[model samples]
Target chain A: MYTKLALLIFIFMSKLSASVVTTLPEFAWIVHNLNPDTKVINLLQGNEDPHFVDASPSFVFKVAKAKLLIKNGMQLEMGWLPVVTQQSGNEAVQLGGKGHCDASQNVNKVGVIANYDRSMGDVHPVGNPHYTLSLVEMKSVIKTIAKCMERVGLEYSKDKYTELLAKFDAQIANVKKLLKPIKMKKFMVYHTEFNYFLRDFDLISVGSLEEVPGVLPSAVYLAKTAKKAMDEKVSLVLASNVSPERYLNKFKDISSINYVKAQMHPLSSDDYLKHYENFINELVDNVSL
Target chain B: MRLILLMFLLVTSAFAQNNNLQLINWFAGADIVASGDNLDQGADKENHLNDGMLVREFEFSAVSQIDQTWQGILTLAYHNELQAEEEHLEVHEAMLFSSKLLPMANVKIGKFFLGFGRLNRFHRHDWIFTEAPLVQKSFFGNEGVKDTGFEYTRLLGGALNWKLTVGLTSGGEFKHGEAHEEEGEEEHDHGGNPAPYEPTRYLRASNFIEFSTIEGIESGVSYVERRDGEGTRSSYAGLDLIYKKRVNQYIDRLVQFEVWQRTTKEMGEESFQDLGAYLYFEKGLNRHHGLGLRFDFYLPADLEEEEDHDEHGHSSIDGITPMSNYHAISLSYNYYNSEFMRTRFTLEHHNGVDVEEEEESFQRAHLQFVFNIGAHPAHVY
Candidate 1:
């Protein structure tokens, strides 16, 4: 009887070890893609702005049973994630716990503005928090996610995580190959969010609709930017950018420029590869438009 | 102090090297304001909360890791206009919060704001209007209640998934209530004591509920009770609701409502009740521009004293009663110069009806600006 009880306990612990939890939908995708058997509870939908996610009560319940929790740190989800996790009261999932992981910490953060001032418009002093959008940064972040899972004893299978990483690395390499035509090309974006993506792809942005991040473009500034763009043949526009899109519509002349757009994160995990593929295809389709 | 802070940072960073404790962010900010020359002091002449917005509020707040299981937050503040003196420094909040202390519960202790109604517990920098709501100022002192206490937040995970908080305070002193009195100024009795007193004990409890994130609906109810060694006591209960929706990428629509009731018991006086409520709406036009409007109404426990006494002790005016009430409406526009700097413009109209002086109404306009120095913590969603 004692032997049977010990075996039952061992089975229970192993099953518990396989379960994991993540905060954002992107982190959940990383986990699900790594181990299909692991249950992934994504707190936010892909289309929702992660910056202003709500700490809905449902998260508290979901996180309470989670064995591990992964998050996008660097104040990216500053508005809500920490607060909700604290309310979760799950020791392993709380910050600094064994099951806790801050995915951004391992990657080299870009767009660092030293001695930054808030007057710069909601600036992230450490750096831009959207490095997750960069393929190269994601490559580095992927390894960290795997290592964190291993440390927390949540790695479902060794080869499963490795296979997913290898496949993704190949896909990213192909994406880079497909973007050779847009390499060293110049364009204009709606927000500074695309800075890391452009840098990763060897592309450049000549100007932005709002040069001051987060601030709406003034009429005088817009006219000057348009004149400079027309003069320099910088008529390529990266629309559907993360920030406000209505600003472009206000200036009909500027909106007339060739527009490029992409959506890398979709709501459904099954759509992840498709969106990722479309993202690269869209860039290649309109890079020189 | 600088040396101490630097040493602390170095030690913490070194101590928590591998996934260790480190200072994530620290924010410093200053708030300054200037009022228009043409202003209305309102019917209650005693409410002179603003003179001129100067470099008034200087705040420094830091969040640090104490260890693997503990996180510490320290906030120090300095103001030029808090008292009769030219400059005053104070410790705004110092607390340790941990989620591992209890099973499925978050615990916090040390000096922190009470878990009061929505706006009352907000840091000074987080107020939506240029000035504190008249109800809050009259209910408590200029600064809301802060005390040494312990509190816990836990989810009653079930079908409803209700979040609950319970807290208790061993002792704390209420600010001198007479701060509102002035020689020639009219006084409205909002029913708080005019003298400072130490509370023998205090208790607070609250419950919060949030619906789907897509709809962005959150509601909470809070209750608080305090007692002095004497027979005096006060009990407050309030409900708050917030609705937010992303109308577009740049614009977010926010509507909030709060209603509260306060009851007091004195040694020899009959119990008194005061009621107040506020409705607020803000329309975000873009990432950096927003327009807001707020409406306030309250019925006070004590009547306002409008001096119309004849040579005799009796008053000359008629229809005077012991009950008083007030209503105010303010329209505001905010321009965020940057995430670090914010400028606000407010036009407020206030009126009070007491025993029987003509329901006096007046208007005032204000312009205020706040500039952040370092990393600021994110506000509650």
Candidate 2:
């Protein structure tokens, strides 16, 4: 009985000690795979919108106990993460802290705008913040995370990271082969979420359904987009689960261009690899060659 | 104008040199408003809501992570002459924040909004309604309570996600049941002004939880105490709650409620108390449109008595001036042009017993525009 009690206490104490906190499930998956023994908690759930998450108390609690915090930086989590970090009072995770990891530091960015302002409607001034959609960018983010984890004295396996990189390269090649038939296929997205994905697979993007991120398109804009779709022979309209259904339906009815729904982020890190593979397969199967 | 230009240039140069400093977040904003009232066409008193278009307020802020262990922020606010006798600019907040001073605690020093009730800590531009709630206006002034202070906050991580904050400040005089008061002047014994009792200390504890991905709830309790030069004392206690539901990316719902009570003790006079509360609800129809409603109720210190006598033993109470209850209701429509631009139209009705002990009512309609530029920090939930 005493031994059992000791073991339970040890388990509880381990949970109370510092752990890793991530802003998204994708980062959680990478962290978990990189160090299976490390504890990982994700602040954003699968269904929540990343652009406008509430600074919920649970997020502060998790961040407070975190020794390391990893975020897909380019201002993707700007709306809510700053509040959480400040409220947590955890110096390790605050901006410029030793334990803070910005995964976008070394990754190549796309959709960079010049002289950007809010008039453009929620434009990310630096670049598009959706680099996680690309496997190559994810690899770069993993390297950054590994280095940050080392700096914070968190246990990480370089051998495992090397193995993960090799696996990612194979998956990248597989994705390239899967989309070769539809390479350069013209398509439009609901948001700029898929820019990295499109660039990686050599796909052509005609335009976006949303003239500005987070702002609903007007009827006139939709009409113009429909005309552009026909003129450009756009084969598909790629939308996420959070995209407004009414506008997508209206655009489809007007242009007769089929659209496909993609679950942009995985719900669980346990099966993240499978989800990534299936995400690519779904896109290749949906687009007409 | 030259000073403003020079300040802007200096900030621009600093931003150009530092990659981590965020100059735009909460840096600049404009509040434009037009209101029509039934009280008097254009004879409204100074500082009272007028019947025409006006630039309400402008704000500029600069914030930076100074180092690995500290952050600094400075905000300057300029209000239209309607808010005062003369147009002027004020240093609204200049603070340094740090989390490394102590384990599991954050520290803030300098001028800032006290850690009080939920809405009191947020700036007016961040408020859901065009004006302060009736109760908050009477008890904490139009801008709510703020001063130079030192505050400590701790997040107690557990199932409930609790947070506790305590503050001490070189406080200012309480609003003492008045919506508008002039600087360096105190109105005493009109409707129970704790004119000399300055709020000097405060404590607030808050918590929040997510029921699901689509819904969440937050609640907080706050207390403040003030003391006068002559040893008069006043204490305020408040409770606030909020519930939010996200139906989709474009649609959401919010319900907020706050209640406060103030108890006062004079050197030789009988102790008295006042109570007030407000409830607010809002619904987002889509990304661009929303609707909101707010109801407010207030009762001054003489709720249990018929009148109040001055130190010279003369009765001065008259209807709602010091002895009656007041209620107001407001309905508003909001249009969000973008993340940084919003327009709101509000219709408000107020009812109360007048100085003549007769029921008096007034109505007003307000159109307000708020715009922001540069990077602003994310607001707390």
Candidate 3:
């Protein structure tokens, strides 16, 4: 009798549920808000470094069960995504398959190092993979996700995704209004992760803490950077919490530059826009035009 | 020398300025080895070319996504050791892959490394250690197996994340001195006759699964059957396992193990059974630094004697002496200067297989530096 009930419940659940896997939580956030009913599985946590995600078996099983898999391409997911996909052996989510989605396909990429090499410290040959940092770039990625969902035969309706996108545009415009006063502002970041965010905000970055992409700055390089930041009146020191900041710390107390750790992605925000709002609020609190 | 350098620069400039494609990579590397052998480690007696500090390896590589469905990789290499008379262009690997074969499968063709063991497919410049492991040197002939071949990969259905692969090649030619030490210089190692070409068959199944809740494991099994039609018939089987734990955001602790066994049948002779195994441990202290240890045990297959005795041969515990087994232990520390440059220091202790008396193990040390420049494709984890 219990077995019959279990089978009945299984059938019911299977009909009502569909699973979606995303390499990054930013993509997960978009998919979750689009279809509240679907099971959205995020492979990488919000604060985790996207480049070095270990292809754990649990995550592989998640990909195995997923009908669709979305990833931030441009070699951002190159380290492990191919390995996971191949191991999952899920034909549906394999490259060139209908259910596979590369969010970078339609977006305009910045920081594209043309003649690439390891000299650039783990740079993406195609371009930087941090597109979701900017709300403007996120729109393009979101649109691509929607088209992919339709192409892959996800249950989520096109009209509903379109509506969510419209709401996101409005949310972005509101943030822009708040950030308008700081428009064309100058700031300095420890890493180049904030390039797209600054590009969208019309802000300027004079120098970075690390002279090369991932190498730690030498004392001489730091001194020179501090001078450059001061001459340009760079007001904010932007960096992720995990990025070491001893070099940036030197200039903080001596100069007017204020250090603020930016959120990698949504930590506990209930919605996508709120995540951006939290980061924007932190940015505005530290810097003035 | 000046003319050659100028010609290389001219070719590189042409590659960089092309409009249709501009992604070109150049890897220039050299091995500076300081070795004044305190105890003979079986290298000098054979008169191998691997002694002393040497500048070698100038290679050019490129990977192009031809269109939506096709991708190609081409690498041409020049080795100073092999270019004794004249500089010869060696095509290391030229591969073309098709993702449109089937929704559930992919196909690749051309000359490439056979995807068997975890470390076999890695380039020399990308190795975790300065030298090849004992089993790889003995079974794969110093340079890990590569051949002009076609392969098909299919994703299997399971929660374990399994994949099935099958391939065929002209032959899994163990090209000696083409890359590293085990050039199989002694013709008598293969009974004084080595067939130029043969048919080879390969099959492998692998999976990456969770070892525990947090730690992960990758494991695989492979079988290869080889034949030259004249005298020898062989079948090789291998088992590989890897366990890794993420220590923090920047570091990983890893352990890898592999075992290989084979059966060989020679003309008018009985088949012999042989086996080998290795264990490797690596700790990533951070992104820029790492420590590693590797231990190897090999019981090589006995071969028909064409000459009285050659360099390397099979040893059996049940035979004259169980001490004939090869044993090696290596410890290394690595400094990843950046993505483009790296330096490694290694100290190894090994019982020389060619040494008749196995009382004392030889000590060997190496310091190697390697660097790459321009559009190198990202290595797969």
Task: Provide the lDDT at A218 for model 1.
Answer: 90
What TM-score does model 1 achieve against the real structure? Answer: 0.80
User: Which candidate number would show the highest lDDT if scored against the true structure?
Assistant: 2
lDDT of 1 at A97: 80
Q: Please report how far candidate 2 places residue B136 from its true position, in Å.
A: 0.3
Top TM-score model: 2
TM-score on alpha carbons, each prediction: 0.80, 0.89, 0.78
lDDT of each: 0.65, 0.76, 0.68
iRMSD (Å), candidate 2:
2.9
Q: Summing lDDT over every window of 10 consecutive residues in candidate 3 chain B, give the lowest-scoring window.
A: B312-321
- What's the TM for model 3? 0.78
Q: Kindly list the per-residue Cα lDDT of model 3 for residues B33-70, writing each as its tens digit.
A: 44333353443333223446554455666676666665
Candidate 3 scores a chain A TM-score of 0.89
> What residue pairs clash in candidate 2, if any at all?
B24-B374, B24-B375, B25-B375, B25-B376, B26-B376
Better of 2 and 3 by DockQ: 2
